[model samples]
Target: MTRALSAFLVLFGLIAPALAAPQNKDGDSAEAIDLLTQASKAVRRETYRGIIVYLRQGDVDTLKVVHRYYDHEEQERLISMSGQVREVIRKGDKVTSILPDHELVLVSEHPPKSMLGGMSHFSPKRLKANYQVVDLGTARTAGRDCRVIAIRPRDKFRYGYKMLIDSKTQLPLKLNLLHHGKRLEQMMFTDIAFPDHIPDSEFVPSYDVHGFRIVRHQAVHVSESASDKREEQWHATNLPPGFKLAEDGVRQLTSDASVRQMLFTDGVATVSAFIAPAGLRAPLKGATRMGAVHAYGDIVDDTQITVVGEVPAITARRIAQNLVQEKNTAKKAPAAND
Candidate 1:
């Protein structure tokens, strides 16, 4: 799991905590649930277009997004307006990302709904069990009256979330990612409008004068034995509250033989951990900040593991230290105490 959340924040351009306000009182409010439920529904049923800016440490990116929601069909197109020329188009379970100079396109098959799309996750009750949702009063965004809902992390491993949802339609107007009292990063619809129609041609791919090349590649493979087997049996004893294993596997980079990865999420935030053997060719030990996302690496137990996510340095450090590779046995297994 290469800092799962950090890479995702860069790739998807959604998710983050920005600008902090004081914590809200804890409660199970019919009003809060009703407000959040409405916002989730609105994101699914409405068609909108807007610009989203992703800010991390020193990097800032603006992406123009066009979205359409009808029936069971949801389509989105994202074009990078700064930095490198990158584009991503998604339809339901399929996503294709195109890189200009690299002349490569990567495709992923996903569940119909993902956290980035503002879709529901697991059961609302499961999330409420670990997070305390509270009403943080109101704010004005893009001329819309918005109600703020704060999700306070009940434990240390995970950060907190505050959202400004449209009061009229219950749609998310802005989202803030918070760690310990400070706003790490944020994403909001600086300007948004519910459009009546979006032409199908808008979703088509764009090509330049030199044309392009396609590289069809399969998913990265990890050997079940030998040197690569270490990652397959790795486990963690300490994790932030509300976070659970979401996805895991190996993804081959263009330059590597294979890279093993593990993904965890708390419905909204995702963190990826990547493991490779330590050697002259392994990744370095250091931390890099991009807007609200943090990428950090260290050599642990002779294995080079890099933990990156939209989380605080302390959270990432604790997660890195808690990784334990237990020995296997044929008998009943005993659970490790935290």
Candidate 2:
């Protein structure tokens, strides 16, 4: 029932006309898609340092970001300059997060395919299936001229995006996540500097970690023997349209317990389902929404199933309730290709 979704439903009827011929619609679509395509690339390939103002649910924080690409690879470092001396470094599939305040370090390796999801190049054709690309004219952000663009979602299951892309560098100076035509989250660059060289030491953690506790998230490797059909537990039968299972695996959270995880995405929104022993997680207790995160839980048979995503609470609840114990294994979709 969001305004964006309502607008999208009406927009669908005009899609054919929009793409028809020499018209402003066609030009707008192409321009919006082109800008996003280039911005995604610039975010990963270009080396830059900036101060980003992040706001969500009325709270704001100023964070510093540094990204560099070399030898056909990309690396990033995030530093929280206000509250605590915390930093996160990403090098390919492995990410290291350090908390100087708590003397802890978290290391986790994501599915190599989804590791660079944010930086992946976008496909206009594929994107058009779920969103309406519109040009919102031009504006100024971070002291630079920007091409304002809005990506309105076609369904309530996903959120819309508004971006102010730098005209010169093709980078997003301000990005906002919207719902009901309201900004739910915003990330805007207040100051930026593109430097010639950002040393490797800037990415390294400088805090004293002599006695820090380390929590390593063991990687889940789906081996040939483990892929046998009978070993899988549950499958989702009522998944929302356009959503595909991107990855699924089993990981041992403790010496006595192991959990099954399934990841799904509909090009924009990502959802995760975690199944563990019945008592490990609280029973299905409706939906819990905090800011942009929506979570729901349920007890399926003897397993506790929790579904969480950035989408609406209804989406998370529907996904959680669709868990079935049938033996049919879920076929995962291939990684998105740009």
Candidate 3:
């Protein structure tokens, strides 16, 4: 896949899953949940500037970020301080990615979510059912005292996380993505400052883009007739325990092609399945990994199925294998709501 397509898939497929929470038996469940709750809120409510280091697949990239919350909305800017010169600016649901190296700009509507720094707001009752939350004592990051908390998966289907939350602001100063007790990705802030005010100009793009190619991704609208037909054509036969289909729809990928997307979540971890015509492009027939994200692809009934998530390889492979085209006209269960 091209770099732009890979980035789009990561945004729409991998990072878009919702989380469900359960109770923890290993540590103080109430304290763990409360701390997580606070950290989640701080990510959205606090306005700060920081320098963050991201480590993935033995590669490190640094970023400078400025975020502000005003009028109940979020405005943030992130600029790469290493490797390629790229920038991401978000104002609420609209996100613009600037690639200086490619002279390209991608604009899309994305929910405010993060795989590295932000915490998903989840139900404690639901979260406790799938994972064990524990207080792992104290640690220090960015010269500030922090509380270490671990959210370990109850099974091997999903990944786990270790977070260092700032003692005063409740912001996450460090985060580690774990799989099978091994670190897959890590992000930590080396310096951060909470500012009283961040001007609007701070969120503007730093690079000039007078001749850059801008690509806008708009939501596709399928008619009721087409939607009903698709509902009878494909469905997932088996879902992992605690997982449920959260969202499914047809998305326009090009003028002549569209793909059906299904999002599944077990409250904390999420996976996404995409189905398209086998001839849409070259089919991916195996597994691939990029840091904590795992993707599996296969062909079913001449249709292409690809599953991607921040879950284990087995989880993605199982999800892809279970997505089958219906041989009969039997109606399937509707997707669940978050």
lDDT (Cα, tens digit) per residue for candidate 3, span 1-338: 12221222232222222222334345545566677767766776788998888888899888888888899987878888888888998887787999989999999774443222233433345555677778898999999999998878888788887888899998778878888889988878899999899998999899899999999976433335547674445667667766766666677776766787777777667788888879888889989988788999987556788999888888888777777666632433322321
- Deviating ranges (above 4 Å) for candidate 2: 1-28, 114-126, 223-226, 229-231, 281-284, 327-338
Ranking by lDDT: 3, 2, 1
User: Each candidate: RMSD to true structure?
Assistant: 6.4, 7.7, 5.7
Ranking by TM-score: 3, 2, 1
- Tens-digit lDDT track of model 2 for 49-87: 988777778877777888788778778787887656778
lDDT of prediction 1: 0.63
Better of 2 and 3 by TM-score: 3
TM-scores of the candidates are 0.74, 0.83, 0.85
Count of steric clashes across candidates, in order: 25, 1, 11
lDDT of 2 at 260: 78
TM-score of 1: 0.74
